[model samples]
Structures are given as structure tokens and as C-alpha cells.
Target: MRPVFRLLSDELIERIISQARDILCDLGMEIHNDGVLSMLSDHGASVDSEKMHVYFTADIIDKALETAPDSVKLFDVMGRQTHDLTDHNVYFTPGSAAINILDPLSGEIRKPLTADYVEYAKLVSRLDNIASQSTAFIPSDVHEKISDSYRLFLSLLYCEKPVVTGAFTIDAFNVMKDLQLAVRGSADALKEKPLTIFSCCPTAPLKWSDVTSQNLVDCAKHFIPVEYISMPLSGFMAPVTLVGSLVQHTAETLSGVVLSQLTQPGTPIIYGGSPAAFDIRFETTPMGAVETQMMDCAYNEIGKYLNLPTQAYIALSDAKKLDAQAGLETSMGATLAALAGINNISGPGMLDFESCQSLEKLVVDNEICGMTLRLARGIEPKEDFPAIPIFEELLREKHLLIANHTRKHLRDEHYFPGRVIDRANSSRWEEEGSLTIGDRAKSEIARLQGEYEPSGLSGDILAEMTRLMRAEAARFGMARLPHEDL
Candidate 1:
């Protein structure tokens, strides 16, 4: 069995779900979309039309949970299955929607350009540890209106991996969906083999913005997979206690499940969140705090309890630079999220409260992801029951270097990190100039970029995507998209 971590007992999980149900029935949620409100009203939910509030009964919640799938399957651009988001299986992905990127040479944070985004996509396509590529950071060169679909377009063009992305506006969703259809060749094919998981977030204190609510509805209609990101700030937007915050998270996420199921039964959705621990003194929400990590693990347990695939925005740091604090917080969060078996772990390469992306940090976190994946595999008996024979052979030979058993199991049993991790001894370290993690990461980045080849998508598909992007860009007065051949 895989190693497991839980912060809430069976009784506690049941109580939390019960309280969440009570909150929905009694307190209700304010949904800003009129169509969603009307749909909920049609489906037996009590609707306060004047107040824009929708109260769900227990039966409706039960039906929603029953209809939602227990797991979601993801495929790469070429229609190869990449992830089965079920059970205790875990996959790591870089965090999404950062506005700035950390420059490797100068070690300074600045707005990213199209070139920066291209390099990021190429580098992530080469990283084996990261299961999917996210729209990691936004490029300032593009029109602000097309930022959402533009990032998706760039990622799809340069990388073949499935994307973890989101939409910023209701209109952008159509363009983004069109881009996916262009790659998959048809709407039915795109639906049959999903190439992306869009993230839809609900506001804290039980609210859904117009854009996000509409995005959820659109995703449900198209048979696209989505992950609900409910961000509840403990002690501020939510109750101070972790359980209280979890109740709020559950209620908020459950409300989204209801919305999606009501739109279309059996719509794929992951029970995911990005809630943070609110720090009173600084009046800031810290994603790296121990409390935040704890809340992430606990909510994952609740998701599993409800028999749904899980996700969390843990394993990321809030530090501004690649320092000891960055490593400490990121490593701890990644380890915990892995042990908890979150279906899609999103936080690697994120910094400064999820506003910045660091290429160097991303390479380092790739190693962390490797180690955590090995940890989650747990120790299993692999031809070791007959230990006397192996030990006798070892005693006779004085070493197992050339042993057949040794050669076969070595790679599977041990996780050898890449150059980003300093595994050299003192003498070897000095001989290699004692490079810091950042220096090694920089070298790794250069090497990967040198190794990155074309994603091999057809020229016609590429042209169609560019045409769609150009049309969208022209609407915002953008004459040309930066870094494009056109």
C-alpha cells in the first residue's frame, strides 16, 4: 500500500461534510451568474432571485456527488494517455497564472515576454518529473484581453504535454476551446481525449464570479474537465480554525460540483482548492505556511472521502528569491502533498504567493518531485524474502557491484536526482567549482533548451491556431503577436 497522511479522523471527515451540507442549506452561496442561478432554481434548489443566492438541499448535493466521476483521465496533444487521476496516484505540475518570472542571469523578478514563455514551455516539455505543463506565467507583450487564451495557444504550440490552465474571461473560453479543437481536429475527438484541465476558482466566503461561473457552465457543456479552486483565507475570509476553514472549502467546492452536475450529468471535475493560512500580523495569506500545507492535506482527504479526484496548490514557496527559505518551504509542502496523495499537485516553480515563476526553482522542484514520487511508492518486498542467499553472496564477493540482482533493482529502488542536487563529495565538489543549486540549474536549463525539438504538430494545424490567435489579438489593437513568424 502507498504511504498515506491524514489530519482528520473518519468521524471528523463525516462531521465536516455534514457541516458543509448544513452551511449550503442554511447559509447558501451567492452566485453571480443569472443563468446558473436559474438552472439551480430549476433543479429544486431554493433561489433568492433578488439576492442572487442559491441554497442547495441535501438531496441535490447527494445527486451531484453521485453523478460526478470518481476520476479524470488526461491525454497529451497526440492523444496518448498521460495521467489517470484516481486512487492514491499522484502527479506534479508547475503552478499556473503567474504575472512575473524570475530572471536566471540577473536573479530579478520582472514581467515575462513571449520569449520567456516560449523558453518556459520548451524547458517544461523536457522535464520528466513534471507530469503536465501549466500556463506558468503571463507574457506582458500580448494584449491583456487575450492573455488567457494566448498562454494556452503558446503552450499547445510548443509543448505536447496536457496543460493545467484557466480562463480569465467568459469570451476567452471560446477561443481557448477553439485552440484545443484545432489541435485535436474535431470537437468529438477533443472531448473523447481531453488535452487540458481548466481551473475555475470560486471567491471566498461562498461566492462565484460571473466569469468563473460561466466558465464552469461552458466546461460542463463541452464535456471538458475542470478543477474547482476555492481559496478560503483562514482567520479572515473563513473561520480561524483549520476545521472551520475546511468546512468552508468543502461547501464552496460542493456548490461548484452541484453547478457542474446540474449543467450536465457525469461532467468531469476534480475536488481541488488553493486555500491559504491567513497571517494576522502581516495581514497576508502565505501559501508556504505550515498551516496552509496542513489545510491542503486535510482538504485532499475530504475530497477522497467524497470519492473524487483531488488537487491542491501546495508545494510552492512565498519567498522572493531562490534562498534557503524557498527550498525549505517548497520541499516540506511537496513532501506532505505527496504523502497525502493529491491527484494533481500544483505548486512547483511558484513563488511570492503564486505571483512569480522561477525557472531555476522549477528545475530544483523537479528533483523534489522525483524524491516525493519515490516516497509515495512505499517500501515493498522485491525478491528480498530469501535474504540469506544474497547476503552470503555479498559476504563472498565483498561487494554487489556486478551482481545481477543489484543491477536490476538499483534504478527502481533509488531516485538519483539530476545535476540540480549537489550529491558530490567534498573533493568532487571543489573540483567542480562548488556550483550552487542556482548555477547547476542554469546549466540544466541551457542543456534542456539545446535538447528541445519541435513538437511536430502539423503545419496546417499550426496555421489555423495562429490565425485564431491573430484574429483575437487584432480585436485588442495588437498588430502582431511577439515572437511569431508572421
Candidate 2:
């Protein structure tokens, strides 16, 4: 049996859902988009036009839940399926939309450029444990208007893995969608084999802004899967208690589900969020806080209870650097998230409360992810049920070094981590020069940069993607896109 972690029981989850429904029915949510308000109103939800508030009934919530897909499949640029987001399956991805990156050489955080993003994509393409790549950071070299699509463009050009990305504006969605079509060859083919998952966030305390609400509608219209990023800061924008924060999260996410389903029934969505536990003393929201990890695991239970796939921004740190705090928080969160069976775990390489990305942290976290995934697999009988034979051979041979069973099961039963994890003896380690984790990670990054290969997309497809990006860049007053080699 796989290892399982649960924070809420069946009764508690039911009560949480009940209370959330009551909130949607009574407190309601303020939707800033008039189009969404009209759509909900037409669909029989209670909408107040002037106030732009819409109330959802139990019937509406149930209908939305019924129509939303239980699983979302993701494919790479080659149309090869990468993830089947269902059951207790877990996948790791880099945390997204960081405004800054941790500079490896300077040991400081600063704005990233186009080359930084390209290196990031190349590194993620080589990370074995990270199942997908995110538009990890914003490159300041591009204009603000095209920043969203520009990241997506670079990801598609540099990596073959499926992307976890989003658009900041309604217009950017069209460009991002066109980039995917350029690779998939048609709208239907793109829909049939989704190349990316967009993250649509809702504001805290049960509200949806105009841009995010429209993004939800647009994604549904185009058959793109979305993960609702509900960020409710506890004791600040949300309630002081974990239960209260969950109620707010559920209300916000359920409202998104209703909107997406109404826009297009059977639209895929992951019941996801990035809620944090508030520290009153420091006046900060810590994703590594035990309460935050508990909430993430608890919400996954809620999502599974409703029979939908789930995602979380757990397994990352609030620390500014790749120090002990970063390792402690990131590893703990990753362990809990994996045991809880989060379908899409989006947090690795993220730091400083999700505002910064670190390549060094990413390589280290890849090892952490590998360990957690192994733990999630648990221990099962692997054709050794009749163990007497193996033990008898061990006694006779004095070792199992040359045993067939040992040779057959070695790779499957053990996870041999990369050079980042040290397993050498003191003498050997001293002989080779004792490198710190940071040093090993930097070496791994450089090695990956050298070993990186082109994405192998056809020349025609590459030209089309470039043409689309150039057109969007021109609109934002950029005469030449940075990183022409990309």
C-alpha cells in the first residue's frame, strides 16, 4: 500500500464543504468581471448587477462539480503524454512567476534576464524528478505587456517538457494559445493533447478580479486546463484560523469551478491553492509553516473527497537563500505533499515566499523530490514472498553481491541520486575535495548547460512561434526581442 497522509476526516471534510456552500449562498463573492456576472446570472445564480456580487446555490455547485473533469492529462511538445493527474499520483514542477532569481555567483537575488530564463528551461528539461516545467521567472528584458507570453515562448522553444504557465492579461491568452497551436498543428489537436496547464488565481477573501476571472472564462472556451491558485493569507486577508482560511479557499475555488463549468461544461480544472499560515510575531506568511503544510494536505483531502484532481504550491521555502532554512522547509513540505497525494505539486526552486527562483535550490530539490516519491511508493513484496530461498543463498554465498535477485531489483528498489547528494567516505570525499551542496548544485547546472540539446521542433514550427512572439513584442515597443539565439 502507498503511504498516506491525512489531516481531516470524512466528517470534517463534509462539514467544511457544507460551511463553504453556506458561505457561497450567503456571503457570496464579488466578481469584478461584468461578463462573468451576466453569465452566472443567466445560469440562474443570484447576481446583484450594481454590486457585482454573485451567490451560488447548492444546485449550481453540484452541477459544476459534476461537469468538471476528475483528471487532467498533460502532453509534451511531441504529443507524448507526460502526466495522468488522477488517483494518488504525484508530479513535481517548479514554482512559477517569480519576479527575481537567486544569482549563483553573487549570492544575491536580482531580476532575471532572457538568458537566465533560457538557462532555467534548459535545466528543468534535464531534471528527472521534476515532471513538468513552469514559466519559473519573469525576465525584465522584455516589455511588461508581453512578459507573460514571452516566458511561454521561451519555454516552448527551449524545453520539450509540458509547461505549467499562465497569462497576466486577457489578450496574452490568445498569443499563448497561438504558440501552442504552432506546435500542435491545430486547435483540435492542441485541445486533444494539451501542451500546458495555465494557473488562474483568485484574490483572497472570496473574490475574483477582472483579469483572472476573464482568464478563467477564456481558458474554458479554448479547452485549456487551469489550476485555480487561491492564495488566502491567514490572519491577514483571511481569517486568523486554519479552518476559517480553508472555508475562504473552498468558497473561492468553488466559485471558479462554477464559472469554468458554466463557460464550457466538462472544462478541466485542478482544485488548487497557495494558502499560507500567518506568523503574527514576524508578520509574515510562511509556506513552510506546519500549519500551511497541514492546510495543503487537508485541502487535497477535500479535493479528493469531491472527486477532482488537486494541486498545491507547497514544497518551497520562504527563506531568501539556499541555506538550512530553505532545505528544512522545502524537504518537509515536499514529504508531506507527496504522502498526501497532491496530483500536481508546484514548488521546487522557489524561495522568499515564492517571489524568487534559484537554480541551485532546484537541483537540490530534485534530489528531495526523488526521495519523497520513493517514500510515497511505500514498501511492497517484489517477488520475494518466498524469501527463504534468497536468505539461503545469502548464507551460502556470504553475500548477495552476485545474486540474481539483487541484480534484478537493485535499480527499482533503490533511488541513486545524482552528484548533488554526497555518499562518499571521509577519505574519498577529502581526496576529491569536500564540496558543499551549493558547489555540487552549481557544478550540476554547468554540466546540464553543456549537455543541453535543442528541442528538435521542426523549422517551420519554430519560425511560426518566432513570428508570433515578434509580433507581440513589437506591440509593446520592443524593436528586437532579447536573446536572438533563442
Candidate 3:
């Protein structure tokens, strides 16, 4: 059997699901969106329009679960399969919609511009461990109305990989779909092999605003895959116990699934979250805590049990500085999530409790991702073990690298060495300037930035994307899109 781990037993999982159902059926959720309230009410769900509390029946959720697809194939711009979101595999990408970029040289956090988004896209496309790219940071220089579209447009222009992104407004989301159509040549063509995954999240205490619900609704209507990120802060927004937090997460995600499928049966939806343990001392959401990783595996267990694709915020650290703590936390969090078989793991390159993004940290996290995947693969023993014969064969060679046994299996059996990880002796290390991991990481992203070449968009598609941006800008009383190239 393939390797996997879990925290909830079959009975325990059933109970959690039962409690989630009770939470929805009993307490219900506050729906701020009139359209979403109507959509649920028109279906079998009960809606209280005056109080805006909508209660979903277990039957509606069960139906949604039955109709949701078990696997989704996402493709790169070149039309190659990038990731298949299934229980057996995992994919890593950076966190989306970050507003600040940490400068590698100065160690200063600053607002990102359009050029910065292009650079971030290029960096992600070159990282082998990142299966896809996100609109990593929002550019502050652009008009508030068009910033979302601008970031995605740059990602589409530069990232050769599949994209993980979202929309802030319904209008922006429509433009995103238009951009997808422009890239794939037609609407039907875009659906054939999707090049992007859209995400939307509920406000943790069982609240759904119009934008969040509408994003899922739009995704369902367009046949686009959507993921619900249900973030609950334990001890603050949710009950302090881990089980209670899991129940809250389950309820919010299941609600999204039901609403999406109710809008369009057979719409693809992912059950995922970045549930946090509210740090009482600091009043912060520590993304790197042991409880956070534990929660990662736990929610994944529930999602996989339901045969739904899973995602979580792992492969990250809350360290304000990129130091040993960052490496230690990142290594542990990412490995646990990978072993748990999450499909799409985000939060790489995030720091300061995910309020900041660092390209240098991204370089380091890329290496962390590689090693974690290697660990996840586990050992492959093709034949029965004979300890005596193995020992005798090893005794024949003073150095194993010269042995045929070593020459044949070494590359596949061992992780390819990481450049940032220090494995050299003191003398050799001192000869190399004794650079720290962060120092080496800074150099790495700098080198990549120097040599990276972004894949270009087709002329026709590029023109269409420009036109969409310009028209969106016109809504804000601007004549043309900012940073437009003719």
C-alpha cells in the first residue's frame, strides 16, 4: 500500500462530519450575499432572509459530495500536464495576494510594483519544486480597481507553469475568465485542460460575503476548479480544541462545495484550509507552530477520507528573519504535509506570519520542497533484504562510489544534493567564504534573476489581455491600462 498517515479514526471522522452537519443545520451560517442566500434557499437549504442565516441540510452537502470529481488535471501554458490533484500526489506553490516584497539585498519590506510581479512570475517558473505560479504580490502602484487583473496578466505573460490565482470582484473574475479564454483560444478549449486554479475563502466564523460565494459560483458556472480556504483561528475565532477547529473547517468547506454544486452540478471543488492557532502571547497566527502542521495533516485526512482533493498552508515559516528557525520550521511543516498526501500545498516563501514575501526565502523554500518530496517518496526495496550479502558487498569497496552497486542506484535512491545545505568540512567551508544559508539563498535568487527568461505570450493573446485591462481601467476613468506596451 502507498504511504499515508492520519489523525482521525473512521468513527472519529464520522463524528466530526456529524458535528459539522449539526453546526450547519442547527446554528447555521450568516450569509451577507443576497444572491447566495437566494441560491441556497431556491435549493433545499433553509434561508432566513431577515437575519441572513442560511441553514444547509446534510442531504444537500451529501449530494454535492457525490457529484464533485475526485481528480482534476491542471496544465501549463505549453499544454503539458503540470499537476493532477489527486490524493496520491502533492504540489507546492507560493502564497497568493501578498502585498509586500522583502528585498534580498536591503532586508527591507516594500510595496511591489508591476515589474516586481513580472520578476516574481519569472522566478516561480524556473523553480522545479513549485508545480505552478501564483499572483504572488499585488502591485501598489496600479489603480485599486485593476491591480488584481494586472498581477494575473503579468503572471500569464511570464509564468510557463499553471497558475494559482483569484479575483477580488465579480468584474475582475469575469476578466480573468476572458484572459483564460484568450490564452487557450476559446472558452471550450480552456475547459478541456485548465491552466489555472481559482481560490476563495469564507470568513472564519461561518460567514460568507458576496465576493467569496460569487467566486465559487462563477467558478462553478465556468467549469473552473475552485478551492475553499476556511481559516479559523483557534482560541479566538473558533473553539480552542483541535477537534473543534477541524469541525469548523469542515463545515465551511462543505458549505462551499454544496453551494458550488447547487449552482452547477458536477463542479470541481477542493477542501482545504490554513487554520491557525491564535498565539495568545503575541496575538498572532503563527504559521510555523507544531499545531499548524498537525492541523495540516488532520484536515488532509478528512478530505482524503471523503475522496476529495486536499490543500493546506504548509512549506512555510512565521520567522521574521530567514534564519535557523525558518529552516527548521519549514522542513518539519512541509515534510509532514507531504507525507499526509496533500494535493496542493501553498505558503512557501511566506514570512512574518504570511504578511510578507521574500524571493530569497522562496529560493530556500524551493530546496526545502525538494528534500521534503524526497522524504515523502520513502525507500524503494525491489528485492528481499539479505543483510549478510549486503554487508559483504559493501566490504568489497573501500569507497562505495566506485562500486557497481552504488553506481547503478545512487542517483535514484538518494536526494540530489541541495546547494544551500552545507555538507562540507570546516576547511572547505571557510575557503568558500562560509556563507550562511540565507546568504547563499540571496545569491541564488540573484543569479536566477540574472539568467531567467520569461516565456512570452502569443501576440494575439497578448493584445486581447491588454484590451481587457484597458477596458477595466476605463471603469475607473482611466484611458488606458498602466504599464501597457503597444
* Tens digit per residue, CA lDDT, model 3, 1-486: 456767779888889888998999888999888888998888778999999899988788888889998888898877788889996698998977788888777888898877677778878877888899987788887788778877888788877898888888877898889888888887787878888888899998999888888888898888888888999899999989999999999899888888888988987778888899999999999889988788878988888888999888877888877877878888888888888998999988887777778888888889889888887788778432665665676777645566666777777778775566778999999999999988888778777777787576677777887787778778888785546641
In model 3, the runs with Cα more than 4 Å from the true position are 383-398, 402-405, 478-486
Clashing pairs in 2: none
Instruction: Answer with 1 or 3, whichever has the higher lDDT.
Output: 1
lDDT head-to-head 1 vs 2, winner: 1
Candidates ranked, most accurate by lDDT first: 1, 2, 3
Candidate 3 has what TM-score? 0.95
- What's the C-alpha lDDT at position 385 in model 3? 69
Clashing pairs in 3: none
- Error (Å) of candidate 1 at residue 443 is 0.9
In angstroms, how far off is 217's CA in candidate 3? 0.2
**Cα TM-score per model:** 0.99, 0.99, 0.95
What are the RMSDs of all candidates, in order?
A: 1.0, 0.9, 2.1
CA displacement after TM-score superposition, residue 295 of candidate 2 (Å): 0.5
